[model samples]
Target: MSVQPTSAPTWHRLSPRMLAIHPIIELGRALPALVGVFFAGHAGGHGLLTSLAVAVAVVAVSITRWFTTRLRITDEQVQLRHGLLRRRTVATRRDRIRTVDVTAHLLHRVLGLSRVVVGTGTSDRKNESRIVLDGLTAVGAESLRRELLHRTPVAMTNQGSEPADELARLERSWIALAPFTLSGVVTGLLVWGFAWRVEGESGVDLLHSGPLRAVGHGLDAAPTALAVVVVGAAILVFVTVTSVIGYVLAFWNFRLVRHDGGAVQVTRGLLTTRATTIERRRLVGIELSRPLLLRAVGGARTLSIATGLRVGRGAEKGGEVLLPPAPVDRARAAAARVLNGATALTVDLVSHGLRARRRRYVRALSGGAVLVTAAGVGWQTGGSLWPVPVAVVLLATSVPLAADRAAALGHAHVDGALVTRSGSLIRRRVVLADHAVIGWTLHASLFQRRAGLSTLTATTAAGRQGYRVLDVETPVAIALADAVTPELLSQFRRRPAPAPRATMR
Candidate 1:
């Protein structure tokens, strides 16, 4: 028996289940407003019936929205027509599509459906630039994802050449490094803020509640030193547990595959699964970022510096991340694979000189001294000597930090690639192709000129646009730019004077 090929879809409607789910999603979003309405009703501005009527109106609008929306997919474009009173149509050419992401939250997963987002990557406006088909069947969503991505003729041609190469997969052992990468302090603050918000809304004081009150009483009864230790241990445990859970949820079953068409696909997540595809051709460079704590454990994360991957306000986490927290060596290896065997990804960087090091220390110490002096003067007026010891400690700590930052600053060129490494607390190493560079900019501040140092910026059309090589000698910065793209800066190069005639002698 032979199987028949599936016919292409002309125009389609979202899964019928969307009729029920869309209203529920909208209602959940409006729940806070509904709550406010209920409170207002209880306060006698409106009655219970009024609140009920308002909610029903919201539900009616959502249901109407579901019925009015239609999706159409064709060889040339994916189009969406949505709206009730004012109909709006959005059409995006198939060729211009850069990312086709499939996301399924808990509700959609339970319903065996997902949301498909087809993006052009040129517009920052989410609704204007993308077509979202919500509540698509799991199978249908996957098919759409594949179809939309492989629509281009170039991609279709490449599809027959070879199978995708598996690049990286989640290793449970890497979870051990989670705590180092996690911002425990930030997490604690967020938790505290959330608790405070909840308490305010519910009219209950969390800190004064039963369990917390009992714990407070117990601490009050215990020795001060013991109480302090207990509190510290509890905070530590909370941070560690939160970090571990967050890491697991964000990276569960994480996998990276290099498709035959030279696109890197990333699929991961626990409760809300997300799959992102980044075309290798759009990739301008790779950045290996290591936070101070992660660096101590020899761990780093890799991000693709590419165009078209900047999704939603450009702050979307994991949008361009190729590797989660892993050993630096592993991250470098993965970067190399993504770059198609580009050795520049792992090449050693050239360090700045002693002058830069001294400058770093002097700047750090001077800043600290100014701050300390301000604090001391304030304390003197306030009749206190408390700022003296604090100043001493701060100035002392700045010395080693400055040294480390200076040591971390370096730049080099390898195999027609420009590499820059910098930062103290968060070490960033970027490897950019020389051909990607479009222009060069040289900057020297007043102090920098005196120090014979200048900063060179290599501007490109993709990635961060400008990658800087900082604190290099003026001549070195110019030489580096000339080496990368001789023609770009050649117009600004100084010419040598002609030799004097022999007859003058």
Candidate 2:
């Protein structure tokens, strides 16, 4: 859909509700500083008046910013002008736009408003490349999202495109996969660190508080090993509960759909609803990720390998995620649907030879030996000796891990697509289209050269740019490159002498 001005092109202000909510958003963003101010006031340093004044100033600045900001949509581009003392304007060409995502947090949803972000496929700095329109009516935001996503330079008067077919919707049964998908250990450590910080800052021992103290007392009479087991179990339970709640909140009511103009649309989240449109043309490949725990449960997640998607920007939810964690079969099905019948090319990958396997063992065992040696030396120097045994056990375990990793590493070309499988702990199978590959790089370390092995990286304009087929036989790497793009590497290949003397013989 392309939106045009009814009369002369004119600038528009944000929803008036922004005046009420913008300040609150600003304060929320500065919450940590505000908390520090309150702590200072409680400690008899900064007075209550100082905290109040600081908050008031922040709100005043937010109001000024709200009033100064204005947006306008013209025939060729979308423009935003803002700032009080230093006025600034940003504009993005409509044809260059790759994604338009709408997000509504709890407060914004309550106010019937949402935020719109329009981005072009190329900027290193997200803020610089994207235009954000905050606090627009939900309906208005949706309209803008569609208009930006579907607009073309030649068709300025086209009506909004019809909604595309839904490819997948949230399934209640899929929720069972949540606990497996969540990083329970990491979440538990974060929670522990946050509690410790609060205790340190407030000079209150949270562990010795009423409920915690009672729990501690209950475990004090148990054997040391039993107490450790009890505490570990408690932590595991806590982590699992938190992980489940978080997974549910983040992916509540998730839906994936195929939108017009070859775009894929995703709508998800609970407290903060988000609608994201990704241009299908930008998608170069799909990654099927299986973490250790998830793999144990036969679950996997799908992420699009595409250009214009920001990585590590939105908590753990990067822009590339196409499907949340689900059963491995279901994930593969979703990938096929998203790719419009392109099945996963992960079957029957060409394996590296014995030399590669030997190299993996050497690398893993050497690293493990270093750690074991360090631990042993530390123990001899009167440090805690417990880690020495642990290090020895880990070193012994690396043998199997190395074997598994070597067995898992493989690559193959099928139906104009290149498939690469690697990783043991967190397996990732990448399926990239051959045509998407722009170049190839061959690298050989000293050991690799002696072992007649090399790493071949397929370079592309989209996705991670470089995807490797690691530790393949040197001839195989060259053959793979030639098979993928013959003309590009043909000149570098030495042609065998034509069967010369057959006629003479």
Candidate 3:
């Protein structure tokens, strides 16, 4: 008997607007090389020809890419086929979709187009397996996002009118808290790096640039204290301005919405807009962050500790962020709302006791003590008084830092969630749901054991994988683990030695 051939799968092409978008994107990506070429051409008197050739090449590649890319959605899976030299096909099950990100860069926005990224829980920094559709009309992208996430055929217009409850919205006043955040420092470093790159490429000495030379001379002519004050003030102003601009650009029109279809969506950004939708089922916990400077200014940020969402490194700007630097009270409120008003956010945490406090002090001061010893040695051998003052300053600061760390150490179990608070420089309170905890680990170093303390870690499949309750009393750690997961350790429980029989003599 002869078998009949099956019909070919329907493949949909990207938006025609991608023809315009891809060229711009490819050209921008090749800018550094274009810059180098421009400099070389200027010197060789072939500037016009070289630039034209490069632009033509970029456009050719862009057109080829647009022609090759296609995507399709079947009942069982979503498939994508793309690439010119190395033709490739990627597919993922409909149920495996964990996140749907809709992004529009400036050019995309201008052309009414968007890019859709579909992520499974399997992706990480090392290994990435994601399906990306580089170009789609804004309405098509939104409709696809809603269809994939909600598993329903929900056609949407360019501007969606789906009813969603607002969880949080960006406030203009929150910009004040931006200076207290590390964003300014990060922005300054990026700016410095870019300047360094430009100087290296152009063979220019930025430090000896005309304006810089004048500033350097002025500083040299001024008194030491005056120069210090002027430099400090200048740095402060730069940081403040950059921070404010960054805050506005990144979080403009930020809004957190909970859709009726059991998903939470976050929409933000100015020049490059992004909308990320995460299933409520994947949300296992929430994190409240208070860095030292941010804490001093009574500001904090909120992040989602959800499965499939990576929350580390640049997580503050990633899809996991729920709220940017805002008042601490507001942060807590957002955390609570995310947790569905779980008491873990507000419940008083159980202290780790005096032994734990001592451990904190010892750990914090060890570095200072070593520095002080080295300073003393330098004073004896090299007669350096500067080391002594530096060591003294460090030692003095360590005491208060140790105290603050001790104050921050605590954990509690409330409403079937384990709430853990730790750290000093970047204090974090992680409220993890009971179901999220797959296992428990108790660890003790030689010093920790000697001090009758152990670190209890709750392992999960969600963000960070493990959340630690640092330096709790040994018995408390064991009891806490047992309380959270009784069945896991029931067979391994230690039995008390049988009471000695009374002597009959």
Best by TM-score: 3
Cα RMSD, model 2: 4.4
Model with the higher lDDT, candidate 2 or 3: 3
* Local error of candidate 2 at residue 132 (angstroms): 2.2
Query: Against the hidden true structure, what lDDT does model 1 obtain?
Result: 0.78
**1 versus 2: better TM-score goes to:** 2
Clashes of each: 0, 0, 0
lDDT of each: 0.78, 0.80, 0.83
Candidate 1 TM-score versus the reference: 0.84
TM-scores, all candidates, are 0.84, 0.88, 0.91
Worst 10 residues of 1 by lDDT: 1-10
Per-residue CA lDDT of model 1 for 1-505, tens digit only, reads: 0011123655566777777777788877766566556665676767577668888988898888768887776667777898888999988887777777788888899888898777665422434677787877876666566666654333344244436789999899988888887656667887786666556544556777889999988999999999999999998888788878877877888998988767788888899898887666667788888989999999998887765555333222536778889998999999998887888866777878988888899899998899789878888788567777788789999999998899888998887789998888888899988888989889999998999998899997555678888899988988899888988778877789899877853
TM-score of 3: 0.91
Question: lDDT of model 3 at residue 465?
Answer: 88
What's the lDDT for residue 407 in model 2? 88
How much is the lDDT of residue 8 in candidate 2? 50
